[model samples]
Target: MRWAPPGFGGKRRSPEEIKREGWREQKVLVVSETDPRLTWPERELVRQLGDKLYGYRKEARHGRLDP
Candidate 1:
């Protein structure tokens, strides 16, 4: 979206146009604990999936929850 000016009006820009503004190059996107893309259950599902594919975290080792 652009600013609404006297002559020019705000219009929705295409994804490509928006990308060109700052995402012209490849970027590294970090997904942290505070990531908003998923709900709590969804994140838990991903954690479970990873445990199945890889292994449990150190805190979850040997059926214990010690940190």
Candidate 2:
């Protein structure tokens, strides 16, 4: 997901470098179950869906997703 400059060898790129490089970036929303607006079941469903989507997104970004 990242490439280093020629003649520059070291550990993997840091989060700062990744951001500076302008790679695909996403902002995740945080919703707490404690929010009175959402019932318990609704919160659970949202949490599960968010987790699944995150996994799929990460895999797709790294070219690991299946056809």
Candidate 3:
């Protein structure tokens, strides 16, 4: 099951909506210094999907989802 936004009345949502939901999750992947494996396109995809991206090892140390 999933929680939809206030205005989502349809049976399904677009990938952007699903990705946006993933960004709202309580956990996520955090990288340090930007992984070389993440190509420009891949990075852009993540950026488009996520609320924000951080590069702080300190934050990662705490957890990927910590505010």
Candidate 4:
């Protein structure tokens, strides 16, 4: 079962809950390999959000949230 790292904001989410929510494997790429157009703040936001963003993406893909 998967679990969110401790201190994730919002209601606590267990790994099993995340899987049920349709979270999938994600490949991590070096920042330079990511979109060159992304600004520093955008990159920082992505770093800060991390897996939470993945969860959001999963939720969106599953229709749990509006795109």
Q: Pick the candidate with the highest lDDT.
A: 2
Q: Return the lDDT, model 3, position 39.
A: 87
Q: TM-score each candidate.
A: 0.39, 0.31, 0.27, 0.26
**Compared with the true structure, what per-residue lDDT tens digits does model 3 show for residues 1-67?**
9887877866667765675666679454444235577888887666544534544345444645644
The lDDT of each candidate is 0.61, 0.62, 0.58, 0.55
**Mind giving the per-residue lDDT tens digits that candidate 1 earns over 1-67?**
5566664765678755655554545562223333577899877877776667667877668765633
Cα error, candidate 2, residue 46 (Å)? 0.5
Residue 55 of model 2 has an lDDT of 46
Clashes of 2: 0
Give the number of the best model, judged by TM-score: 1
Best-to-worst order by TM-score is 1, 2, 3, 4
lDDT of 4 by residue, 1-67 (tens): 6677768755878755655455345433434214567888887676547545444545335645543
Q: What are the runs in model 2 whose C-alpha is more than 4 Å off?
A: 1-34, 56-67
Q: Which ten residues in a row have the lowest lDDT in candidate 1?
A: 26-35
**Worst-scoring 10-residue span by lDDT in model 3:** 51-60
Clashes of each: 0, 0, 0, 2
Q: Specify the poorest-scoring 10-residue window by lDDT in model 4.
A: 24-33
Model 1: lDDT equals 0.61
